[model samples]
Target: MVQPNPPVLEVSGLSMHFTSGRGKKKTTLKAVDQVSFSIGHAETFGLVGESGCGKTTCGRTIIRLYNPTAGKIMVKGRDLSGKLNKEERRFLTDNVAMIFQDPIESLNPRMTIEEIVGEGLTVKGKMNRAEVRRRVYETLDKVGLTQEHATRYPHEFSGGQRQRVGIARALINQPSLIIADEPVSALDVSIQAQVINLLNDLKRDLGLSILFIAHDLSVVKYFSDKIGVMYFGKMVELAEGEELYKNPMHPYTRSLLSAVPRPNPLTERFRVRVNYDPEAEHDYTSEQPRMAQLSPGHFVWCSPSEQQRYESMMRQ
Candidate 1:
């Protein structure tokens, strides 16, 4: 069932750096540095990291919300940097959709559900009003929304219902890939499960390629087929979701895994968090670290010596 032919989303050496302050006081902050990865067709690739580590920036940049300072972003083998005609540009927008973190802020409060979800349909001029209405109602139904809710404004719905509208909006275009940036992070715990399950079901039914971004490792592991762990604007580790959890080679990755809360009361009470201090943990002065593959699908960002250290640890 693993189709590794063409990647739905591919990014290479992507970097986004910003400068703050004025003149002499200006300091350059590298938000995303030389990140590279690809999501195969229908595969859910999870990007997990702490806040300000550039996970959201990466997602936005991929969707062309923020232009990249360097590197390439290819959607379905078409490079965005190339001269895109009207059709190609339209193709890009239609194929790639994003589910924002905060549903309330993402959805226009003034717009009714029908207008919001059917917004994408406006881009392609083929559908008539009746057809658009039918499509909207059907799509709303797909997201567990009733047709009766279409006339209501965003403010009328609960948090979870608002998110369903967002998802409906994204799916209206029949996008080949979806970048869900902390989609469930803002919802209540019970509501979060409902949204997560909805996404899971949609992926199964629609064969969606999802770039699921989140700060929670447990959620990432549950939803992702593969995962890439970010640290200080760099991809420190990438592997199969279960593989990464079972065998976290990078110090930062191991530290993150240690922090994921366990269900058992005894385990939670005695769990010790492994802190990660970049300065103390790595000495990149001599030779800069790069992403090195330890196994077929496992990659860790480390110097040559550190790579060997991880390999040795895996052997034991």
Candidate 2:
């Protein structure tokens, strides 16, 4: 199968590190190390990994919320690196938006829903009050919220409703790309489904591209066209959603898939267990783990021995 053209959001050699402690005792923690991937226009690219694996930091870095220690972030063919001039920054803001993890914490308690949704427009100063109100109502309706709900504070709504409000705020600007940083992680299971469905509907209706970041593989499988697995700040595997789940490469990806609960008791009982020796430390100086193409559009970054085994297996 032929792969598509260059993606709308192309990240190459993205790296982020932070220094901790003071003076002579300082140590650098490589939060995100040489991660690279791309999301096609109107595509949902999922990032799945355990907590503290730097998935969130990767998302923030892609949007330039945190300056990358090294690497390039290209959105719609525009480089968003270094300090931007005022006009350039404004243009970037209008083009990209983020849906934070916690809607309650992200939304202001003092502000009304209308004010919160209109905040982006107010800051951009591109539309008048009447125009902003019209756009806000239109966005609210698009996310399944009513104009009446707009007058109330965020606290007035339930968790799912609050999330809808957050989505409305992100969509009000008509951004081409959105980074949904675990948008449904905080909600109840039922509410989670509702929010996911709402996001799907919005994505289809608005023709927006998204990076859906979450640890839940099942959710990622349902929502994403392509999935990338991160481990210890490095992207170890990336493939189509079904292909990755059906034939996972890399030890870490296999281990993650093994943990996903099976519906059948027999299958669950027979599932393979992954054992990683905690005493064994990660070695980063070796070769930088170049990605080996397993098949069309499927890639894995593994050691030479593992890559040989995987290649042999695929040939069979």
Candidate 3:
């Protein structure tokens, strides 16, 4: 029998918690709880949820920005859940790069585009000025920026152009996985499409795997091969992009889908939004719900009875 290939990135039972205050006054926030999923080589895995739903926290935790409270994070089948040596830390940093949300905030106001894009190369060490300049120019060109733009600072560029700089910076390192946290959210609607198209082209050209994190379901549907819907800190539903959009089993997932505005006038006029309240949606006081495989490559968090209901709904 042949063994299956491991995912480029896999996360299992991952959790990140934060405590504020001191002593009894301290409050513990479960920023991310038991999140699990994987991204295949060259695949785009979209994570969608509302603000404060732990989507960004989960992405940051995967890239080792914060120490996980529990669970495992595997990069190309190599476990990164444990403490790492300096060498391991450098390796991880080189392999996983992040594209932050706000372009202006992410880029240094004082640094020119060349310095911003080539910073990763500098951190990796031993590159002379000319070598760093060459890679920076090459990466900038790839992201639709010219050599002229490289001489300018972040404040000199428009929001869209600033984001292009961010992309250039992420691509300069040639990372295996990119954690893009709401990359286009702050841009104008027209600029959003341009940036999205640029990312799609780059992904295809680079054969890159991305963990695309955003609150917009429509954008995620356009970008992801697989989609994971997060609520609070838990992933309530996981499925292929089309499957989840067509038949969302979890109540929270359904509620989220219903809220996305449609272009059709009649449909938009008649659509009723679904409001999901966890307390009203589930009876977790008695039988607990575990993540269940509802179908091939589809998973949902539900009790046995709820699972049966979902199965029956699919049948209908």
Q: Which prediction has more favorable TM-score, 2 or 3?
A: 3
Question: lDDT tens digits, residues 1-316, model 2?
Answer: 2234556788988999988999999999999998888888899999999999999999998778888999888777777777778877777787789999998999999999999999999987878999999999999999999999879998899999999999999888898889999999999999999999989988898889999999988999999999999988989899999999888867788888888886799778988877554225234456345777888988898766667788887777
lDDT of 3 at 189: 98
If both were scored by TM-score, which would come out higher, candidate 1 or candidate 3?
3
Q: Evaluated with TM-score, which candidate comes out highest?
A: 3
For residue 189, what is the lDDT in candidate 1?
95
lDDT of each: 0.92, 0.87, 0.92
Q: Give a tens-digit lDDT track for model 3, residues 1-316.
A: 2127778889999999999999889999999999899999899999999999999999999889898999998887778887878877877787888999999899999998999999999977879989999999999999999999989999999999999999999989898899999999999999999999999998999988999999888899999999999999999999999999988999999999999997899789999999989888899888888899999989999999999999999888
The sequence of per-residue lDDT tens digits that candidate 1 reaches over residues 90-189 is: 8789899999999999998888999999989975888999999999999999999999999999999999999999999999989999999999999999
Assess candidate 2 and give its lDDT: 0.87
TM-score of each: 0.96, 0.93, 0.97
Better by lDDT, candidate 3 or 2: 3
Q: How displaced is residue 140 in candidate 2, in Å?
A: 0.1
Model 3, runs deviating above 4 Å: 1-4
Residue 45's lDDT in candidate 1: 99
**In each prediction, how many residue pairs overlap at the backbone (N, C-alpha, C within less than 3 A)?**
0, 0, 0
As for candidate 3, its clashing pairs are: none
